[model samples]
Target: MTGREFLEPDSPQQRLYLDGLKRIEIMQKILNELPKADQNLCYQGSYFLAANASLCGLAANHFFRNILHVRKAAIVSALPMAVIPFLSTAAVYDVFVREPLFSGQLNCEVCAVVRGGLVGAVVGGLYPVFLALPLTASLAARYSSSPLPGKENLLRFWLSVSQPVFRKMSWAVLVQVLTGLYLATKHHGIYVKILQQMNTSRDPEELKA
Candidate 1:
């Protein structure tokens, strides 16, 4: 068969390409439905969702399947996929919707919280790749020096035990989300009070004073 056959509709390559297109469409729909904000960057907002889904899916497929070993693995597989999107949505909300309300430097409460959340999401997404580099090097060195048997079994064992590794990182990410929510609420209350004062003031000069 020639290489061009792979592009045929029934071929695996074509199906993969179509799947990618579908995902992009879905991502676009998500972006469109979000609250429009002056500070929201389309690439950054969409990428946060994409990264969360990819990373969490990786963790679920590699680690959770081995750890759970349940009959309903298919159903359990959907959990990570579903949960990560919501987390990403919250991150996007902070950066796009909440942060823009402050319209100030990073020191401002709303700005600080949202920026912190954005930083945390980026770092969390890259963390797995950072860890994998050293582990990959070690594995390559070991395999090159002395090839070992039952590598597949060893991999399965590692996957089964690796839940804790990601769990610790997840806690840090969770803290960033919580911090943003808390600060936004606190600062928004103060902003409301300021608005109320301005509205109630009898004279514009007195309000400014």
Candidate 2:
């Protein structure tokens, strides 16, 4: 009954057309419910979500489920949850941090950029474990293909590196020592500066001191 079915001449094409049309219809309905008075942000967010769905949805089975060997059921719900944190953080920076704290000051501007970038990287690195893996597995099982890449493969790779005596816990202790020293000498100062700017009642003009 969708426009795709009506437009397609062949049976296989008809199914593709109808299914796509139905999804589009549903998305349009949801988008239309957004208030027209301030729709720019809503539209941008909707578009980002729609694009994520297309990339991480059933259509992406070959890349994620088949070749990558991910669980079949996880794709349907993964993208929105994974993307939301990053998108929300970006929005927060744009609307809040940029306007209130930055004010064209060179150091504050640099720190704001660094903080947002670091937050984004941390979110991106953790998203697969926190959000994507669970959602698609739960919501889109029928669309997903199964038999995820077992942790055994990853374990094997780790073992290969860890068998060497140099790869043992000694490296960790050394790195920790170096990190502590670096933080004590440099990172601590930077942290204090950031904290003072964020918390102190000192007027912004006095900050240069």
Candidate 3:
């Protein structure tokens, strides 16, 4: 069935299938038709996102162990650290890469910079609320920093929440903006190499298609 036709169906199953198909369509276009320069940025953005998330997660985990004196099983702590930042990265990446490139606005230097700055501001502003809060709360609770008798929970909450955000927010936003500029400006040397690797690595039959 045509993807468009699939989308018109009211059945939940049809909707789910349509969603998957839409994602596949989008990915194929991105991988195949996007300019080498933009494609490179996407690859770098993904790598940068992973690296940034790892750093933030590690720092948060370190705080729990060193400052709070709470140690968690390696896997238990590592999973959330990996998952949370990647989630935020997905949105930032969309703003930095997909939104501009897909809309054809990224070809112009001024538009790209404007879009990047605006998106970075938004992503940075929300870092504390979205990224920091849950991470802080989780780490704080993991260390069992519950309120003591005669002490308000508010104080503990404020301290845990503020510290991480204050330490990371500016850095994170700067990374986001720099990423946008890099993707928009950097040479496609790495991107070309990555595509060549993918092409060489694909199965013969798949590559033929």
Per-model TM-score versus the true fold: 0.31, 0.30, 0.51
What local distance difference test score does each model get?
Answer: 0.46, 0.38, 0.52
Instruction: Summarize candidate 3's per-residue lDDT along 1-209 as a digit string, tens digits.
Output: 55665466586768777665554444445465557665656555555644565555555555544444445555666666666656665576665655555443345555555555554444433342345345545655766764322256667756764566556555765665665455444423333433454456545335334
Greater TM-score among 1 and 2 belongs to 1
The clash count for each model shown is 0, 6, 0
Top candidate on TM-score is 3
**Which parts of model 3 are misplaced by more than 4 Å?**
1-38, 42-44, 105-108, 117-133, 142-157, 168-173, 186-209
| Candidates 1 and 3 compared by lDDT, better number | 3
What's model 2's lDDT at 64? 30
Q: Relative to the unseen true structure, what is the Cα RMSD of model 3? A: 9.2
The C-alpha stretches of model 2 lying farther than 4 A from their native spots are 1-63, 67-75, 78-87, 102-107, 124-130, 139-144, 148-209
- Candidate 1: residue 53 Cα off by (Å): 20
Per-residue CA lDDT of candidate 1, range 1-209, in tens? 78786777688888877765553444334334444551244324434444554454455344433343323434444454545544655455556544454332223555545654564454334343234323433433444532323676776655534546567447545644554345454445433444454456566344223
